[model samples]
Target: MSEDRISRDTEVLVVGLGRFGSALAATLERLGREVLAVETDEYLVQQWSHRLPVIEADATNPEALEQLGAEDFQVAVVGVGTSLEASVLITANLVDLEVPQIWAKAVSAEHGRILRRIGAHHVVYPEYDAGARVAHMVSGRMLDYIEMEDGFTIVKMRPPRETHGFTLGESKIREKYGVAVIGVKPPGEPFEYATDSTHIGADDLLIVSGDTNLLEAFAHRP
Candidate 1:
């Protein structure tokens, strides 16, 4: 979907009150947006009734969705992750309703492709992405990172003991390590961007950007 497809005035419809759906609804409400959430189960509906406009209806049922004014929503998110069949059917119904944008969650790459083919505007593999992130966090000293693209990344890493007490300019990290230090968080002070005079200290968290493998190696450095 385009960045500006949904504006402040646009209403959002979230189907399925699973963890992902409930969290999405809460966040949208927190952002001060009007949200309509639908779930087939009465218990799930009650759980989020106070959070947003909750409707107990089967989203895969086109008639049910229509009764809730689904077509009036600017965007719809299908968060049914357990059943691919249900996800696809709901996606088809949303398309039939002519919702401007529909985002659906899929369990695998194949499911994602199928959802796209069935008219979902965007398909997200949340499980796959979360698994990769968890693996990275458990591997070594790597704290966290954002996958910017295929070959590049931005990561947070704990400073190595070898660089202790060295000022950023004196160490010449960019010249030698081939990774640019974007910012650093000291023991207690707020994070400071990498400047000529910035000094490296123990327990400092460094934010660096560079090649993916190179950044991983830096993260694992002793």
Candidate 2:
């Protein structure tokens, strides 16, 4: 979805209140958006009912979704990844309702592809993202990591001690390490993408992306 797509509506229908769905609903509500959550788990529905409108029903059932005015929602999220069949069916139901945008959580790459084929506008692998982040934290330099397709990654990290006195042009990071320095956020300064003249600072956080092997090489010291 385009960046502007988020402006479509603040009302979001979150189907299946798993960990991801529940957290997403809560966050959206905190942002002052209207959240309507659906779940088959009666206990969770009861637990969250006071916080938002929780409908206790099967989200895969088109009848229940339609009754809740699913079509009126600009965004719908399907987070039932445990059961592949159920996740696909629920996504299809949301599509049939013509929700403008749908975000679905998937357990694997195959699941993600299926979700897209069935009409989910975006599919995410939360477990994979979390795992990559944790791995980067335990490693060196990497403050954050985003895994991209084909074993590529975008890494945000503090400039190494060796970079304190060098300008980005002088650093020759792209030439020396084969990883692109996409952006930089200096201490007490706004973040900006790279240009030859941008001076590197001791406290700056550099954003870079490239092959996983190259990123690991650039960050590895021992």
Clashes per model (N, Cα, C within 3 A)? 0, 0
lDDT (Cα, 0-100) at 4 in candidate 1: 82
What is the lDDT of every predicted structure here? 0.86, 0.86
Global Cα lDDT for candidate 1: 0.86
lDDT score for residue 101 of model 2: 84
In TM-score terms, which candidate is top? Answer: 1
Task: State the lDDT of candidate 2 residue by residue for 1-222, as single tens digits.
Answer: 454766744688999888999999998888888899999998999999988899999987899888988988888889799999999999999999888889999999999999999899999999988986888867888888887789889988777666676877888888888888898898888999888777788778899899988998787743
lDDT of 2: 0.86
Q: How many backbone clashes does candidate 2 have?
A: 0
Off by over 4 Å in 1: none
Q: How does model 2 score by TM-score?
A: 0.79
TM-score of each model, in listed order: 0.91, 0.79
Error of 1 at 124 (Å): 1.2
